[model samples]
Target: MKKIIAFLILTQSIISCSNSDDSADDNQISGGKYYAVGSTYGKNKDNNFTQLASVWIDGVPTILSNTASSSVANAVTFYNNDTYIVGTESLNNGNAILKIWKNNTGESLTDGNHTVEATDLTVNEGNVYISGNEFIGTLNSSIATIWKNGQAIRLSDKTSEANAIYVYNNDVYATGYKIIDDKKTAIVWKNGVETVLTSEQDDLESIATDIYVDANAIYVTGYLRNSFKSKAILWKNNSPATLSDENDFSQANALFVHNTDVYVVGCHIDTHQYDFVGKIWKNGTLVKEINGANPKSIIIKNNKIYTAGSGLDEKGMNDEGKIWESNLNNLDFIAKYKFPNNKVNAVLVK
Candidate 1:
């Protein structure tokens, strides 16, 4: 199958302090140095629809990838005044080269002979850890992989992908899915040992997209899918707990834990996948349901709740990246900013 990329102009609106109080308040939304990682669509040199990996700082975007191929930023992290971004740059052959950017400079981890992607990353003691998958061309199968300082570590022998990574006490933890008997079973790996988070069911599929580990327990969030319904799930110490209601199907995209309180963000869709509404859950209870959107990342900084993701376009078929700010206590609206024609994947506040 051939991939068709979308082309759209991405524009940024710089908000700054002005004479009006409303303008100053709006500028305070992203007051400090803020970062959002994603991709923006534009026409490349060939006049073809393509994208460039970018990091948005205070609503202004700085492109990170070369124009040789289309690229995207899937995750972002900062450590000791250095910024790290992980994603992929596509080749004409449809293969992707896993790309990493440090402080707006980019490099390739792979040669682009086969497909490779990085969804999340972390920096511990100046060592870069990235979670992703690399396709084995001859076998046509993908393996869940972790890269430590540019060295690849495989977590599975079969089809699998790791979407999130966390390092605690120098122990590496990752979560995603492994294919079992043609079904997807959510899994976690601690120091390369596989731990199953869901039972393999022939008629059902499951995935663990995010993982967090502490002294208390291992926390993960994703979804279990059957034919007609999907449920947002949180796994604590390998035990499954659904976070969705009976009336709607849902998928948890990412989660954050603060002061022993688990905070999750995702989207709820109807059975037919028509209507969509963003939602937040606190400690297994529904805290708020946002506008129609899909939140990809959520975090709490300085007692403020910040979410970065995409909302449906006018046609409700495409995604337009946005950042939402709200009060952490009551989930009340504080501010919002939209990036035209961009798809945000991660956010970082400094």
Candidate 2:
């Protein structure tokens, strides 16, 4: 069934004007360090492999052109102070490619030859990290692995999948799930060390979608489910916390930590199956719904909150993409735009 989603304008303006006068064009178009997927010059959904791609501030999108012809970009993370951006790419054949772009030049970091599917991207210091699966010889049996600078480190080879990655103090953390003895179990890896965080329950499917690192701890958020519905969850030092009201199916996809406040973005499905209402959780409290849309990424700069994700139209069909920027101090929404859909995934303030 098609789903109907809404992108609402928070009538209240919480964004404030700052003393620093950065022109919109200068701030967004010139020497910008954010990451996104814009529509390739000529591609669409009918191509069976067409999707969003990464672009630079200079008005050019990062693409391999040859191997990733019909690839859809999932998410992007800027590393090394935005000097480098890393994300996942897929080919029309369904094989995934982990690609790295330097600046906005479209330079690649994949040795120019290899098949991969990157689910998440992150970096610490000068190191780039990716978590996803490595394809197995023409089969569906891909192995869960995390790559550091293109070097593959398998976390779980047990017919598993890795969806997210984070680096804290140079220690790598990857989360996903594995099939053990015909049961699904949630898993997390620290520096390639495997640790099972949740058991294999029949009705439970635990998947960690994002990771947040602070000076002292790591916070992970995703969804855990039984046979019927799922619930939003957070893991501190690998411990779980339920964030949904009873009977509400929810998920937290992207995470950001600004000082002592922790923010997460995703969607929640009410008991009536309201079709995954877009949601944000700030420091353990349900703040506001940007729209009936799902949030893919979030950022806080200069005390302003910005969110990027997508929503569905009234016809219950996924609509155009979006970006929401909060007023000063993030007291309310300042501006909302139908973000370009060429293949953008994530946004960064600096």
Candidate 3:
């Protein structure tokens, strides 16, 4: 059976920061401090392409050590003033290796023996948890896997993949999907127990991209495919809430809950023009939209909302990493940072 791959668009757009300077060693990029992790690509002297894992501290770019092959930094977090990034690095034998960077030092999670990718990461009480998928056997079927402190735990029986992970109250929650009878089913695993979030009777394909837990409530965001279109969906304690209609293709990539209000950020695809429009929904209401960009992750700091991802450049030809900030007092974007030729998969505020 052919695999049904789910693509995630990571883009965002807002005003450029005025404090950007030409200094290469500056610790801050846009007058404020923020950390972002992603990949940077360039052409070698022989005109061949090369990629490197990169992390930015307050806008200062730092290329990670492993340059043997292409690498990507997928998620970033700060725990006890130490930075951590999770992603994958390619080996010479054509296998992808899961790797984590702590304070700019790279630690390989796999010995390049199997294919693995770390999509999201979280740290709780000094314990690190990373979520993604690992291929099994010659069939290469994906198995949703979570790694805690370098220990691997499989979460799925058949073909599955994990996108986001959260650890709350000493319980680990992983959000992703599994192939049941050849159809993808949205699921959440709490302490290794599986809970199906979508029903087959809906007659639509679904996926849960990100998960969050607050107190006693659990929230998961993604999209449901209905015929030719997809609609963004949010599940609050297993209750489904539609964030978008069936008119267009949309998915929620990340979400945050603050003071009983839920905020989700993702992308809506315009079929006619093939454009990806960044969107943010607040409590099931459309809050913001931007063309040619996709919001990947969101966070609330100091009562302000910030989203980090990638967006089309001014010429609309190439994509660049960007960060956008907003608040309830000002619904409009307040500040932004753009780094050319890079894509930010995650963001951390200090």
Task: Tell me, by lDDT, which candidate is best.
Answer: 1
With candidate 1 superimposed using the best TM-score fit, by how many Å does residue 182's alpha carbon deviate from the native?
A: 2.1
lDDT for 58 in candidate 2 is 30
Task: Give a tens-digit lDDT track for model 3, residues 189-289.
Answer: 99888998955346777788888875768888877775467778899898888888668688778887766788888788776665678898889999888
Native-vs-model 2 lDDT? 0.58
Q: How close is candidate 3 to the true structure, as a TM-score?
A: 0.88
TM-score, every prediction: 0.87, 0.77, 0.88
Off by over 4 Å in 1: 1-31, 199-203, 271-273, 313-318
Better of 1 and 3 by lDDT: 1
In candidate 2, what are the lDDT values of residues 1-350, reduced to their tens digit?
00113311110100100101112211222233444433343453454435545453433455534345554445444433454445445555544566665564454445423465666666555666767777665455657888777788888656776777766556777776677667556677888787777522346767666666556676777777754566777777777877777577666666777667777776775445445577778777888775556666777676577766555544555555556677536447532555444434556555
lDDT of 3 at 19: 9
lDDT score at residue 61, model 1, on the 0-100 scale: 89
| Cα-based lDDT at residue 90, candidate 1 | 85
lDDT of 1 by residue, 140-188 (tens): 7879999999999999989987878887777888888898878878889
Please give the distance, in angstroms, between residue 78's alpha carbon in candidate 3 and its true position after superposition: 1.4
Candidate topping TM-score: 3
Models sorted by TM-score, best on top: 3, 1, 2
